[model samples]
Structure formats: structure tokens, C-alpha cells
Target: MARQETQCVIHHSKLTSYCNVCGEFVCNLCKQSKYGKHEGHHYMTVTEKTNELKEEISEYQKMITDKSLKPLRENIHEHYLVKSRLDSNCDELTSEVEKREKHFIKEIQRASQKLKNIINGHRLEFSPGLASRIAQLEDKKREIDSLMKTCENVINTGNTYEILEFSKTKKSDLNTTHSSPRQVPKLELHTPRSGSLVGDSFGNIRKSRAIFTDEIKVLKSWSYDMYIENMFTRNDCVWISKTGFFVSVKPKTAEEVERKLCPVHPSGFIVTTSGEIIYSVSNEHCIYKITPALTVRLKHSYPYLPCGLCLAINGGFYVTMHKHGADGKIVHYFNEECADWLEIMCYRKGVSLLKKPIKIVENGNRDLWVVDAASESVIAMNSAGKFKFEYTGSRTCFEPIGICTDSRYNVLISDFGHKMIDILLQDGRFLTSIKLQPLGISRPMGLCVTKDGHLCVGQGNGCVHVLRY
Candidate 1:
């Protein structure tokens, strides 16, 4: 190809040289600095500059041919591929929505048909007149209304993540449900054998109670060597076995369980929001974190033994530990590049709070539930660690040990003395008890409410019982 001649825009003159001072194209006339602010400017002859431009243009064309063009074409094609794949997935999602809608409609229709059959039977046993029939119709109407309300609550109130996460449990329920009218087991509060009027330190008794089942099905059990200390369950059940090894029924992502040495009996563990297991070792005065990759390392070490720990949604770590002298204190720590234990909040010893804090848990509202051993009470405090109310349990919480909160923010305390797990309201009211007598859950040591809403109770024995309410 013929080389195009360059022109200087300012003078409208043929660019016969390169100006070094101004770093721009200039004709020979503009090269004199004293004449036009290009005083004594360095200039290259037109043939030398033309040769340099020709070399640069040659290199640029070679780059486009050999390197840049193929990748640019591939990037353009990749956009098309991604768009096509996303459209296909959108179609699949629409199909899934249709399937879900049909399934719910069929179930609703079947339930309405059952109600119709019941009404027809009631018509045959026509002993009661219009007034009684009207009452029965009103009851049926209420039942239908309640069903609609429950369904709406699940759909509307539940977060997108929780609804998707509970899909597995919902599918299991759907599988068990049939056209036959299934009888739901009635949940009732059993009167304690002592028949004593039970009240907590706060004086607020339970307005609503928890239900327990006599039949405890041990889904899986194993023989362990020592006390099964604490169990955490999310997608699977995790516990430090008696042998000091972490055992899980469903291995998360098939990662090998790392036998990272913690305290022989670690005080407690919090499965972090990121799925890492952070355990507090009372003996070592250290906290260790185990990653999903099965890598265990010392995450943080403290001066005093960290007896219990709870993690907030914002990744703040609240710990209850054994202080050297009187009672242990609650320490709020933030784990950034390192574990920075910000400061000790409440460290006083009185009949009211902070005496040998054994176990600790945080509720939905960030209230701290510290099970104090010496005081024999669960000292609940607000987010600021201010004294809210001390719950000495319904029957003075017998040897309260492990503490955990459910999805509803109800606190579960394992009473070793009473051989029961006492459920309490977050505000320190006594809710109900799970008497471990018949279910073989004696010595309920470690208590945790699973993400799937199952209560995993670790016993003095090696076995951990997973119970549903």
C-alpha cells in the first residue's frame, strides 16, 4: 500500500519532520522555537520519521493478525454462548414454576374434596338441626381459612433463602402426605412429676409451651470413648466425638474430617455463617477454626480459657470464659485479620449475674444467654450486656450446662440435675421441658437446634439423639 502523507493542522503545511519539544507533528517552518514557541525544537527529517511510522504500523498490524484478533473474536462468541445458556436456564425455571403450581393446586383440590366428603357424611347423620349444621359449617370454614393463612405465611413471611433452604424438608413432607386424612400427633405439655408451681427469677411463667415426643428414634449412633461434648448441625450433624475427632453423618462436600486437637472436652462450637467450625478450648485458652477444606489452625488464643462462644450474623464473636478469680466475663471479639477481643463488657460477680459463666448463646435480637454455673442461673442480657433478667429456671434450672437458641429465638438449656432440657422464652420466661426419662436422653450434656429445626442432644454416653418437635 502507498504511504499517506501527513499534514500539520496548525499551519496546513506538509509534515516533513518530527518536533521533539512539543511532542507533536510540525512542518519545517514551525521548528524554530524563537519564531513560534517551538524555539530550538529538535526535529527529525521526513524520511527518518516516515521510516519510524512505517515500522510501528507494521508491528501494530502484526499484533492484530497474530495475537489480538482471535481472542477478540472468541470474546464476542462467548457473549453469544452465555446469553444462549442463560435463556435456556430461564425456560427451565419457568417449567419448574409450572410444575410447582400444578402440584399445589392438586393438593388443595384433594383437601377440598375430603372436606366435601365429610360434609356429605354429616348430612346423613342428620340428628342436629340447622343451628348445629351451621356451627359445623363455620368450623370447617375456619379450618380452610387457617390452611390458607398458613400457606400464605410460609410464602410471604419466609425469606427467599430460608424458603429455598427448607425445600428439602418440604419435599420430604410432601412425600409422606397422601390423599388419606393423616392424623397429626397432638403436642401437649406434660405436668412435671413433682407438681410444684414452677416459675423463673423473672416471675414470668410460660404463656406458650413446647411439645415433646415419647418416641426418640436414634437415626444413627456410634460408640465413643469419652463425653460427646458439643454438636452443631446445619446441612448435617457435627460433634466432637469422645475420641476427640469430629464426626458427621453427612460429610460436608466429602471433605475429610481433620483431627485437629482441641481441648479434650471443648466448651462449645459455633458453625460460622461461612460454614467454618470455630471451637473454644477452655484448657488451651485458645480458639481454633476448621475450614471446609479440612484445614485446622489456631484462629485465636486468649489469656483466659474461653468456656463458651456464640457468633452473630455480622461475624461478631461473643465469648463466656473462666476468669482467674471470681466469675468469668463476656468478651466480644471481632475476627478480622486477627482475633481482636474488643473488650470485656460485664465482669462483675453478684447474686444477679456473671458467676462462673459456663455456656453462652446469642439470640436473634443479639441478647446474650450466659449459663452461669455458680449462680445456677441463665443470665440474659441485652446487646449491650446490660442485665435484662436472671432466669433461675422453672425449677431453679438444675445444673444448667449447654445452651442454644432455636429459629424462634427460644432458649434450650440442658438441665443435668433434672435430666431434662428446659425451653425458655428469650425474655427469661419458662416455656416447657423435654423430660429425658423415657427417651433414654439421660445426662443431656450438649444441646443444639439444627438448621432443619431438629434438636440435637449430645448425651454423657457417646450417642447423640436428634429429636424433632
Candidate 2:
């Protein structure tokens, strides 16, 4: 066996420096030597290199721990634990309710028994006398009573025994009638106020929604070449059907109208306010436009790749660019005269430009919403390219894939986690979450609000789910 060399072979000395240029450890003599391989190379002290490596290790550890494991599984496990505890607590509450119910039943039985006893005592005191009076009234009770008293008085003069018997019956009847009127039997029960119960038990549980049904009515389905990419609902449903483009005019009543082959393979598209559609093709710098008159023409040929676009409410249109190796920017084009796109918003503010923008939409405020996939955030900017705000999931961690807004300025974002759609306010406040997994909708990509107040959620692979908003 041969012993391994621990020292640098060239300098015959222990390692002292790390050559950053050559990516190797070297001795102090070799690192500074003019005749060695690492001569004149940028080098760091061994301790410095060790510290740098440690920092890198720390960064990688933090990435895996925080991003991969903690955010991914920790939230799930935490919810599962909470669900378990909630179930246990529910059972305990149910047991407590049963115990209370038994107590209430026993109390009610006792109250009912007391009422029954009072009624029975009333009956014992009144029935016999009432029945005898009714029987005698048929024979004229006033006259009979007078006659009986006279006969009793006459018999008492002759025989005192008959008078004693009549007196005994009369005494009993007088005692019963003269007694204090039986206490009226009345029922009372305690009830809690409805409005105050919610205030006490559930904190901030103000919004209440009644779900009519959980059944997913699978209204329509259409198959395309590859998969459904981007879609928008104007008066009609315009979508990229994998291989080409297609439109469903009356989607609620029909399936699809016709299929058109755009040989360039479109990436994303949007319907303009003037009944015209503008689309972008993959690896193509040209923006194509199609009119309702079925005319196809090239709108503009930019030097950079046009990715996604949205027609603005302010007579202009917003377009996002995807450069080869740089951050993308949204440009507002207002070419009212010809195919020449007049630039309106290209002033990029520092740290405000989108990294890699995908889809674009304009809100009621005429502000542009840019979905930047690289940054994992929906960037909102004013018409003048001023940064408005960034929504990157603060209430719950989610990947924003598709986004849409309703008439009430409610923003709905398709979350890639748990197959859900997150609802947000126009000013970026969390409202609610709509889970679509029950409907078997997965990888929700394209979202649009229809004209008749229905939400069309595109499930990537040529499948669309329609929901009544």
C-alpha cells in the first residue's frame, strides 16, 4: 500500500490558498509563484474559501428548508392536525349536547308531571259536584234544594240523624267552592337571541354563503390539437385550441363554431373592444389581427417577441414582451390610423418592470395586470407604467396561474395549489377561495368572466368549466 500525498505536489507544502480562477486548492508558494499553473491567479485564503462554502451551504439549506419543505408540507400537516383536533372537539361538543338534552328532557318531564297533578286535583275537586249539579238541574235544582232543606228541617224536628247526614254533604260542597281559586297553570321557556349568538361564538364570521349544490354540471367540453392555452370571453368565446384558434359564439347553447389554422402556432391572444382579435405566435415577433369580417392581417412586427396582450378600456391596448435573456416589459399601443403601433407606455421604472410576463388584463380602473411567472406574482401598473401593487399571496401561499375579475371589481386568481381559485378584492384584499377539485378541474390556466355573469375556467387540456358567479 502507498500513502496518499497531503501536500501540494508542485510546492511540496501544505495547502494554504484556494485559486478562484483555476478552481483548486494550492500552497501559498505555488499560488504566488510566477512559474506555477496557478501563477498570478485570483486566490482566496483557505479560511476565506471555507467561509464562502459555508455561506453557500447555508443558502442551499435555507432554500430546501423554507421553500421546499416548510411551505409545501408544513401548511398541509398543520391543517391536518387542526382538522383532527376539530373532529375531536366536535365529538366532545356532541356528547355535551346529548348530556344537556337528557337534562332538558328530564326537566320537561318533571314540569309536565307537576301540571298533570294540578289538573288531576282540579278534576277530583270539581267533576263529582259538577256532574251531580248537572243531573239535578234537569229536575230544577233551585226547587229541589228548597224542598230538601224544608224536608231536612222537618225531619230534624222529628229525627236529628237525617239532618246530620244532609249537613255533612252541604259542608263539604261549601268548603270546595269557597277555597282559593286553583293557581292557573302557565308554561315558560328560556330562549337566546339570534343576532347576539353569532357575535359571541364566531368572531368575524360575517360573510355567509349558501351553496346550492356541489354537483359539477360539466356544461361543455371541446377537444383540440394539443391543449387549450389562452382564452377570453367577449360576445363570444375566443380561445387557442392547441393546434390553432377557435371561437364559440353561443357557448351556452352550442359547442364550437369553426376551427382556423394559424400556421404560426399562437402563444396568447385577446379580444379587442372593437370586435377584433389580436394574437401572438411562439418565436414570432409579429402581432396578428383578425376582424369580425373574417379578415386576417399583420398588425405589427416588433423586434422583440410579443407574449400576451389585453385590450384596455381607455381606447389603447397593453402588450407584454418576452425577450431572450432579459426582463419583459408591457407596452401600451395606440395605433388608431394604421398597422404602425404608436408607443404609449414604454417608460420602465427601475425595479418595477416585470421579469417574465405571461398574460395581461386591464381592470375597470384602466390599470394593467401583468402575470409574471418568473416572479410568481401578479404585477399591477398604471396606464403610465407606474407600479401600483404586487399580489404574491400573503394570506395563503399560492402560485398565480390565471386571473379574472368580475363586475364588482372582485379579482379571482386561479391557484395551482389544491386546485383552487383565490378571490381577492380590487385593492388586493383576500375575500374567499373557491376549490375546483370537486369538479375535477386541474391545472386551471385561462380564466375569464363571461358576458352573462358566468366564469369560464380553462383546465389547460381542452377542458373548460363554467361557473355561475
Candidate 3:
């Protein structure tokens, strides 16, 4: 074989100008075409530029490596901290579960001991008839034990045939026992033990009779004219004075035929806190604040038709608007001049604040409670309008038109349709419903709980009913 000739690597070189700073090649003609001002600019050959670029790249990589380690160190530290907190929480939960399990086991043991005592007491009264029943029960127990043992063996050994056979036998035995109705013994039923009753002597009886106090006297009823007449009737909203008195208002049309103005028509009567007669009014869109001297003052004008009003914990009054908005429109106003006012009413997600807001009351926590007649739900929100929870009213046309909270945080919602009241816990748990007697509450509008815990509800019959729990 002929010896292979060595081939030399030939490198191409041309008159190319390279930028000294950026290492880009430029033809000699382009470099020569530069103006007089740029002729002195630093330029280099391709080989020199390449070597300079390699040195700069190595330095740049070192700089990048120095900067990248900081975030990596912080991330590792954060991961360790999170892992430690998770481990601590897991240990705490495990301990809590174990403690609960121990308590549950002790409770089960106590129950078992109590049951054993009951069984032993029954055995002590066993006669010949009971002995025959016990023998039958023992035979049934033995049969059940044998069936259970077979089932366990089949399950452990994964034997389908044996499992099917045992299941069929058990089913047949159950069917036979179920077909034969067993006769139970008619033993004397034991009466539950009661504490000893104490008898009162003649003198004690007389002393108890003497403890009767003075009876409450009823107040005389007053006649009041219907101040609201010939107007589109909206609702009746009422408010009590600081000294526990009643004041009501409703809407009435203006006499001017061209100008159909809806004004507040006042009812001229008031009631005392002790179920005594006071005065009343039939006004519209205006809040009547009663004085101690029985004089009514128009505190503020309601933007829309007002249905209910209640005093908040901050002394600010909350009034519900009964006006129907256009379809798909929901707007809430804090005051009558909402259009001119800068501050807008707050609202939360998933809550339609303006949908038939009828009754507004403040709870012990100073949170506002609203009864939406359209939605048939009672909604509770914080002062800042953050939604807390909602209690759905009954489905049977029990429209909740009045709502109030007692001192114990028990919510009382008045259903105008059902002519009754539903009580609920603060957490929206249903407690019970109270049905009003004589069933003529045309519309239960407003509710208030007195300082003595007496619930006072306003009905459409121009009367307020008081109930004591």
C-alpha cells in the first residue's frame, strides 16, 4: 500500500477590519469608507478580536456564577423553615388525635360496664320461661359464630367457592329465622325512679299565695287617621324613640295632579316599652324620630321607599329600600343623596345588596343583619360590608320581612306570608318557629328586642305585638 500524504490545515486570512470592543468583522473597503472623524476609532484584526472576546466571556460567566448563588441559598433556607413548621403541626395534630382516641376508649369501657350490669340484673329475674329463651339464644349465637369463622377463613385464603357456600348458608339461616317470628316475653315494665316529692303545709301554701304582685293595667286605644292615602303603597317602616316608644311612616301621593310627588305620611300614635299605648303615624319616605314630649321630628329623607329601619351600634341608622330596581340592576345607597354623595355603599362577592332589602338590624357583634324578601334569606354582614353568612327562609312562601337579634345573639326572623316567626342561632342554625295566634298579621314589618329581652314585632294591622320568652 502507498503511504498516505499528510494534509495541512489551511487558515484563510483577508484584509478585514474588526471592532476592538464588540468583535465584529468589517471589510477593509467599509473601514476605509469611514469619515475623517471616525478614522481614529479603535479597530483590530479578527484573531486579536476573537482572543479579547474569549477573555471577556470568561469574566462574564464568573460574574453570573457569583450572582446566582444568593437566591439558591435563600430558597434552601425557606424550604427548611417551611418543613420544620409542617413537622411541628403534624406532631401536634397526632397528639390531639391520640388524646381523643384515649378518651373515646374510656367512654366505650364505661358503657360496656353499664350494659353488663343491666344484663346481670335481667339474669337475676330469670325463671323457667326465661331459661328456655336463653337456651334458644345460645344456639343462635353458636350458629352465628360458626358462620363468621367460615367467612373469615374463606376471606383469608381467597377461596371463592368456600366464600359463596358460606354466604349462601348464612342467607338461608337468616331467611328461616326471619320467617319464624320469635315470641318475646311479656315481662312487667320497670318504672324509672324519681326523686321524693315534698308536700307543702297549710301555712306554706298561704305564704306562697301571698306572693302575688300587682297586675299590669292596659292602656286605652287611640284613634289615628291614615296619613298615607291614594298612593302606590310600598311598605311600613317604624322606629322607636330612645325612651322606647313607637313611630311609623308610609307613602302618600301629592294632591297636585301634574306633580305626582310621593311624600312621607305620618301615623300619629306611639307605644311604650311595657306594652302600653303611645301614638302612631302614616308617613312615607321620611324617618320620624319621636321626642320624650311625644313630638315627631323628620330626621332624614329616604332615597327609595323605606321598608324598615334600625339603629346600628355606632348610632348610625340603617334603613332598607323597598323599591324594585330595573332588571339585573342592584344598587345600595347609604343615604338619600347617593347620587351626589362621594362615598358609595360597600358590597361583597355573591351578595346582592340591593335586592329587596326589607329589614335591617344590628346584632350584639355590631354586624348588620338584613332580610331580603326577594331572595327569601337573612344575610349578616360586618360594618364594613364583609359577608358573614346567610340563613335561607322557609320555602312555603314564608317571606321574611322583619328581622332582629336578641341579647343572646338569637336571630328572630318574621315571616309575613306564614304569619309566624322563625328563630335561628347566630351561626344560621335553625332553632324553632313561633306561630302567631288569631292569624291576622297582614304583614309583619319590623321587629325589636327590648332591654328586658321582650320581642316586639310590628304587624300590618297597625298594632305591635309583644312576646316574652
Number of the top-ranking candidate, with TM-score as the measure: 2
TM-score to true structure, per model: 0.50, 0.51, 0.37
Candidate 1 lowest-lDDT run of ten: 197-206
Q: If candidate 2 were superposed on the true structure by all CA atoms, what would the RMSD be?
A: 33.4
Per-residue lDDT of 77 in model 2: 93
lDDT of candidate 2 vs native? Answer: 0.66
**Which ranges in model 2 have alpha carbons more than 4 Å from their true place?**
1-218, 236-240, 291-302, 336-349, 394-397
Better of 2 and 3 by lDDT: 2
lDDT string for model 3 (331-424, tens) is: 2333322322111132556545547665566678766777776778777876545677877775566577667677788888878777777777
TM-score of 1: 0.50
What are the per-residue Cα lDDT tens digits for candidate 1 across 1-469?
A: 2233477666667777777666676776677655456767678877787799899999999889779888888999999999999999999978976885676556556656665665555553334565576676677667667755655455434545665666666666545532234243443544432223222211221321232244444454454566665766656545454455566554223233544444355677766666667777777787777775654545545556777777754556777867667556776665622344443455335443675887888899778888888878888876556687877867753688888888898898888888888888777866677888677777888877766677777778766666765
Tens digits of lDDT, candidate 2, 1-469: 1222457867668877888898887887775557477776787888899899999999999989988888879889999999999999999978976885676556556656665665555554446766676665545556556755665344323234555576676776656643444343444433334324433323232132213234334565554555555777767554544554456445576456655545556667776657566777647577777765664555554667777777766455667876767667776665532333433232345454577788788788666777888878887766656676788875466688787777887787887765777777777766667778777787787788887777777776667667766
- Determine which window of 10 residues in candidate 2 has minimal summed lDDT: 201-210
TM-score of 3: 0.37
For residue 177, give model 1's deviation from the true position in Å.
63
Q: List ranges where model 1 is wrong by over 4 Å.
A: 1-221, 251-264, 291-303, 336-339, 347-352
